[model samples]
Target chain A: MTDESDGNPIERTGDEPPDGAPPGGGQRDRGDPGASDRELAADGGLSAGAETDSEPRIAFYGGKWASTIPLAFFILWAIFQSGVLGIGDTNGLVIGALVGTILGMFFARGDWKTYADTIFEGMTQRVAATAIVAWLWAGMFADTLQVGGFVEGLIFAADALNVGAATFPAAAFVLCGLLATGIGTGYGATIAFVTLFFPAGVLIGANPVLLFAAILSGAVFGDNLAPVSDTTIVSAVTQDADIGGVVASRFKYAIAAAIPAFVAYLIMGSMLSGASLEGSAALRETATALGLVHLLSMGVVIATAIAGRHIVEAISWGLVVAVAFNLVFGLSSVSDILVFTVTEAGAFTSLPFVAVGETASVGGSLYSGATGFFPLIVLTLLIVSMAQIMIRGGGFAAIQEFLLNSVATNVRRAELTMVLGTATINGMITINTAAEIAIAPYIARIGEKFNINGYRRANILDANTSALGYIFPWAGGVLVGYQVMVGPEGLGAEYGPEMVVNPIEVVPYVFHGWFLVIVFLIAAVTGFGREYIPDRTSEEVSRA
Target chain B: MSRFDKFFAGLSFRGSTPDYDPGDVIEVMVTGEEGGEVVARIGDSTLRIEDAPADAVNTRVLVAIDTWDEAGHRGTGTYRETVGKSAF
Candidate 1:
């Protein structure tokens, strides 16, 4: 446990078959593309003809510890700049990563061409590709729901039920949790609820930050439990668990955590009541029929997803149903759902987050929802590439070895170590799915050593990953959600920076995220929901 | 660290691994022979059967931990019944 990392990495060789290359083998440099194509008769993708992939070549950053310098620096910088200073800017992280990688290049021992090729190779790893594709589908479905006036249905429900000002936050938690679960994307839930629910909750008299916390908590709940969630998919795939098995098995933990979270929201909502809404009751007498119909659209997603459809297929169905419902019910105009027009000069003219132009037309909800994750997908790719570099250089292995030796001495401790280690890493990376992918191999390896059930490992990996990613102010989920809270369009117009809920203020209030961490830790230490690997596993259950 | 966490900690599921009390019966499968020690898969993990014939390999058997090391993975088990091949 106390040993400093020192190990020889496997070198790629010509005799090795592609599958024989090793774990994360596809991440190795493909070599010179053109010449290799002719030599090996391979498609000449990454490092084909010239060199067998199993051969260990010179590392870009000299060796394992040196290669890790850039990533270590990024984590440290992230902690100081975001964790301490409270700045949650992704651009800053991008610059930090870029500069850190460039610094590694300066100290690298390999040829410049080899370093560049290796970077390209790392960028194309299959693990990153899988998560990014899932994100694209999830983002599209989430945005489509918003465009179809799903939030309006919730507002109508709130009015119809005569939800009091003191109870709105708790109600918002449950409703948003359901929406996020059906959609399987936290950012979507955050944007929709923060935009639609926050202002309405405020107009009806609720503490702004408490309301914001409830919304974030709901997103965490949905993201954790939703079978279609990207984190769920990544955890299952990376750990080789069945998706349905992971969802069903993890459901107990999520509910265990959610029970306390809901009650906390209720207690907080009552205790933290805001100014009275004297005239708010008369603002809108009747809820729109169109708004109410979108509830059926949500039901379609939840039902289809639970019935075992593939996440991409399920989301596609949800998107179609939502679009159909929107049009049939006349909930929103065609332009609202699929507009391609420039913003008019008025309240929308000063849209802070949206990039609309007078000459060039911009898209509406559907387009915005799908494309919103482009930057994140790009970031995810770069980070995965950077992780690949660490892998090839032996940095990742060194960290794994340290953890395996120092922390995981037995089955009980190993599971506990995995849960805590996953939570700690997620807090550093601040993107739940990426963090899940990064630490997944460790979870798989450690769990397998003890023959822990694949489902249990996936559950632990995802529970912590999803929980920590949303609790922190700097987490991508929180930041994306916060952007909606402060943007100068729609809800943002009503609440400027002054009224915007400070992420720090909402952190403790994110009851579900905190409770989830607690639940997983307790589960880890006590073996709650822990299932050992059976001879006949649930591979079919996952695909189901 | 708090009383709340302490209360919850006691509520977990007996640590996934079976609580190996004496006189308890369980199923295991013969997995391998390491050196002179015979290994069997029980509780979803492998353990050495203390006294089992080489012919017992790849067959199902009933056993209990002869000596359990909760902190270390390796342990020896005492065979209770030599069952046939795995049914699954």
Candidate 2:
């Protein structure tokens, strides 16, 4: 086969046989094949029969391989730095990101200018836009609610449930799940619930690990299914499905898994409720004080979100409402609110003298608000740039072509492939938004080929990815959970182990994650409750 | 060329192509880095394909495909691809 004029080997221009072609040739015409082969070749094609070739298949330490190589190293360094390896603790991810970016340039394959452009693009669009937006809006809302005592209100609500000690953890689990769904962030939910509910659960004689697991489960549930969740949006948009359809289709599967998990937590809570703490009244009073001032913020966020507003717009409104509540409810003076919002602990202290472990001053607060997302923002940029690089490098086309061809033969296998593929991407990225972006094209393609309903595909992809992310210890969700576990009043003493539930320990207790997987698998096999396949011919008419 | 031929020629074979009903059994060849050959039954309109790591010698696997007909009927026929890639 001669290479084509466009430098593409096996490139097909027309779909017809050559004139005067012999019958029964069973061979593709010169211009019959698509652009798959050439694309693959450019992307470091798999060894054809493994003959020895010194062509230097993109080395990790080299410039052409910088993105993948440095990313891997950064993850490893972060794992170690975050005390995942039980060695001396350091900021592994932070250091890894810094060193990795610098080292990446050395191994990049293109010219200095191209590499610089790629890096800048990676930092700005992927990292800055997505991660910064997520952190800023989420952080602003979280901080606003904190000042308004939203967490305290939730605590008071939980206490008022007056459930038996045996069922308290389960109740907490449900409450946390609802809170996460309402807030549209698993990490925020994990932090808030763990701070409030974990300590309360421990004080109330519940198994600390179990309690922690409940919180984690709730986080996964909300992350997997919430309409406003970044994961949900990414999944739906990427799959080309509407948000309502995605949520509705996913509801059956999510609930199936969640109900059993909820029951199991109740059972476990009953078995584990034996610990007791004194001064319940004092804790109640504190919770009540916080609760009385913050009730409206939750309502504002929920109402705005349910009104079908854009996420940013909804969150902005929520923030304004929270600020208003702070004033109207007399929760904090305007000055105090301003100071809390703007100041961090370090700024108020003397500049010349070192103060140990002080709260952030107003300037520090502003700085953190601005820069706390820098690392995530940078990582997001790198990953997106890497994705673009991969696409440009032809890796995406190669994989996509292969998937489409394979999916054409079967439907069941196609569904499973979408589920597993989404999960794998989520596992690697540990961020649902990134994972959805990376995998949505493939999922949508495969689903469409089988004529699978968009809603079903979106639900399965998002739910599985969301569920699996929190189960991986390296996942952001797990990391947040671990941070909560290690806090002063976490599960450390009660569980007799460090507060951080090893990813392994938490996996078994991540009932929602496990349940979601099983439910998806069952739905795939049983074909129960599958929705009608959309008719493309009718979409316009229906919409009109 | 006939209208159908022109249509097929212009059709995108990417993810946006409309779905087809591939009767009781459908055969597909996975071509790419992890290329392989597999056949599966179409139970619904969707199909899932799984490709392992490049080093894993196993051929790509076809796990499931939705064969459910639009009328919720289960039977044989080559369903036409209606929705095009442009919709996505």
Candidate 3:
């Protein structure tokens, strides 16, 4: 074969791909440069420089609207499973997503090969990998801090303050918010606080519903603002803004909502009556001030991240410090950080972090923490793939065009669309981060069309996602907290069924979450904190 | 911006349509073509660019403002060069 343009003779051995061809040889028209480019684009392998332009565009049978069926189906499945059924299973959602993607294949207009190739293209995108990498690092760091007794230290501080029942909700809100911010997992914070702080507050005369709301409010606060938080990471990376910059820019919005929330908890704590439960004194005895040493570990992460260091590096530093604190302060044994067990005593049994047992397995804070996000990570990649399908199929562009032409003709309307668009998606999807991932592309397209700043776009996307995720009864944060109230080892086990706060009862009392959403709504209309593209540009995403 | 400045950024209530001064050079993405001229739309404001390449649409370019109408939030500028591509 002769290269058509260059007139160079090309010899092709049977079934052997030419040089520069992607592995897993596919037919390529070597004579036509455009044909080769199309083949490479379909493969989506190597040739990073042409990624953005060469991306495959898939067409659907039902026009642009049909492209959204995969994601929309998954969202409905999520609502039904997690919201209606009250089953917060990430693995189930994964299955729903897998089925949804396979279903979308039936709607392809032409060659299904392009549609299939698009899945690999979507999964391999840098955006998905970026969030996954950060989440894994953050998972390890946050879990280590938990093993180091960060929650107990806060309980100790709350005990020392002795603010009495009237102020306990306020105090718990602040403390829970701090823990959530430090650990970057609001669901984990919700479980910890509900288990440790909820019963104590009820025993001391704080209303159960108000106290539960306060805890959810705190989770929302941290989830919205934490640099290492999954939602925060998604919002930042989706908007192409650095995590540190996103956190810094969003502080004003978070604090604006948090202040009123704290005050509401205080006022309501005083007004609402509690069941005169006993044993508050017994709960206080288990806490230790030594657990507070991990505060420095949290601080190092925040400071280093804000200084423009990579998130992985910042969390690694925090992990190192937390382990050191655990060992030096004798808070937890070295084995608690990491340990391996085998059926028989082995040479590695002598190691400080190793143990021998009848069953071979691995256990420890780091192991559990990193592994905990596995389900979520898988769900995220699948969701992003669905999103890519939408993008290539022109669903996103069609939606953007409709919104811009009808609803978002002006910048104010654009901002309002973004705020409401995000809130609507999050309301239907039980997992806030997952919902954020699904809706991020829309926010980016709408925001960029109007030249909105990256930080502002990220803040708007995260605030609504974080807030709505906890305010609804089916929300992951609320559901997790409610579970602790009724689970076998929960407050009901000790305090009786009456101690469990009904999820519906706490809806209005989630002051922080309600306020955060309202703040964004007001910001959207009043143009408060509005920024244009020319106002500022974010630093490189790698530094986040 | 410095670390300290980051926390305080975007504190103001910015206008929907901002006015630019003549001779001010700024980098912006060329959003589309208007009446055979390249244009960059920053919020409600629009700037028509002259001397821009045919393929400048959807690409970032530096432009020097040559005329302004603050009331209409519209202006004209001269394209300096292509700086980058759209961020996907």
Instruction: Point to the candidate with the largest DockQ.
Output: 3
* CAPRI-style quality class for the chain A–B interface of candidate 2: incorrect
Chain B TM-scores, listed for every candidate in order, come to 0.62, 0.22, 0.93
Report the C-alpha lDDT of model 1 over A1-544, residue by residue, as the tens digit: 1111111101110111222222334443467332222122111122221243343433543445666766777777777767777666666766667776777677566465655666787787666676777677777667766766677777788888988778888899899888888778877788778766777787788888888888888888888877668888787766655565566667678889988998997898889868443445433443454665666666776566555566667667877887787677776556666654554555554443344556657676677776877766776666666665565555655565565556765567788889898999998876677667667767765665454656778888888888888888888778777778666564446544434777878878989999998988877777777765432243433232
Relative to the true structure, how large is the alpha-carbon lDDT of every model? 0.65, 0.53, 0.79
Q: TM-score (chain B) for model 1?
A: 0.62
**Model 2 agreement with the true structure over A6-80: per-residue lDDT tens digits:** 111112111111112222122322563432233222332212212212112222233232445455565556555
Instruction: Residues A308-375, candidate 3: write the lDDT tens digits.
Output: 78888888998899999999999888889898877788788899888988788998898988998899
> Candidate 2 overall Cα lDDT vs. reference?
0.53
Best lDDT goes to which candidate? 3
Order of candidates by lDDT, top first? 3, 1, 2
lDDT of 1 by residue, B1-88 (tens): 2322311322337444443443445555454445454564333334666777644543456777666555443456787777443111
The pairs that clash in candidate 3 are: none
TM-score of chain A of 1: 0.82
Worst 10 residues of 1 chain B by lDDT: B1-10
Predicted complexes: DockQ each: 0.09, 0.06, 0.33
* Candidates in order: C-alpha RMSD to true structure: 10.1, 11.8, 8.5
lDDT of 3 by residue, B1-88 (tens): 8899999998777787888999999877665554456677778787778999865655668899999888777888999988665445
Could you estimate the TM-score for every candidate?
A: 0.76, 0.68, 0.90
Interface RMS deviation of candidate 1: 12.7
